[model samples]
Target: MNAGHPIPGPASVLAGARVMPVLTIPSATMAAPLAEALVAGGARCAEVTFRTPDAEQALEAMAAHGGLTVGAGTVLTPGQVERAVAAGARFVVSPGFDEQVVSRCAELGIPVIPGVATATELMRALRAGLDTVKLFPAEPLGGLSTLRALAAPFPGTRFIPTGGIRAAHLAAYLADPSVLAVGGTWLATPAHLERGDYEEIRRLTAEAVARSTS
Candidate 1:
């Protein structure tokens, strides 16, 4: 596999703080406005989930937004990976780590942050040469306690816990030195998106960022 491309430095810079707002929009057309709201709210990046029908288009819109560091989320296949990169995603994320997807991303040189839930999955990711990965459905998988436990043995690995995460867990997750960032849909809830309440989204994002940094 060819190292396709270098992971943008901004990704590491932003993740170092441990706050990445994940967005699952209804359509790709909503991507730009939503991204603007997130950035205004203080988040410099977003993970556009493939759950929506317009995932690829959304990724393109967010990437074109300029200031926001956009990534493709919920990625499950190598085809999606290829399309995502072509659509302008800066990185790739999956609910679980798939060797084919991971290796494909590795070859493409795109920084892939796959999901993990147990020691087994974590170890698999480690063997694949990944130092950063996501902890899916973060809360149900033991949340902070689980992360604390994993940290001791895999001190070199960093996690971005997502799934069932709320603002309440923000501090605990970010406080952990090994946590690269936490992903959740809290910042872009359905009600907020339906109303196109960019201001409110922006405010919440800023608050989340401030709280994390504090």
Candidate 2:
């Protein structure tokens, strides 16, 4: 499936936001607490990935918190999209684009941000009607330089660069008018979650938001 087509909700809910937190949590129980930390710390959006076994439950937990714009990430299949939707995911994101997944999400009116790595893949996504995409492994894929190259051709597109992204790159990515936001897993690492150090998470969230808007 391709990207350009609109997903029929509030893209602004995710777009241009200062911080878009990406997390791979281990259990459903941590979702609320972590989400609370993020919001309290100033982040109002997140992408909860399915890398862990309890992803669906975690999504449910986070959704129940209210006020957060939560998206399901690492979504690789139609089945996963179904589960994520059932768990109340408002949007779906993947490391790469899959025609079947994109089609399914569209059918259900769910927004999808599929990954693209090159000019060819970016065009492929655009052909499939996707205007918003995720640039995975951002730094390895050429980081800010690659984004600049992409903008020349896909002038109307918006991106959310994930993977290998750091706090230092926040301003560079967010400064671009074509960039919607960025995703990274460092904010909610296992060690911090294990210790339930929500205060630190809140601090980091504030710092990330500040950097993105700076």
How well does each candidate superpose onto the true structure, as a TM-score? Answer: 0.92, 0.93
- How large is the C-alpha RMSD of every model relative to the true structure? 2.3, 2.1
lDDT of 1 by residue, 1-214 (tens): 2244333322463555457888888877678888888878778778888888888898899889887888899999999999999999888999997988988787777889999888899998887777888988889988899888877888778888998999888998888888878897888876788888888888889889898879
Model 2 gets an lDDT of: 0.84
Among all candidates shown, the one with the greatest lDDT: 2
- lDDT, residue 180, candidate 2: 80
TM-score of decoy 1:
0.92
Q: Say which candidate scores most in TM-score.
A: 2
Task: Give the C-alpha miss distance for residue 132 in model 1, angstroms.
Answer: 0.7
Shift of residue 5 alpha carbon in model 1, Å? 9.6
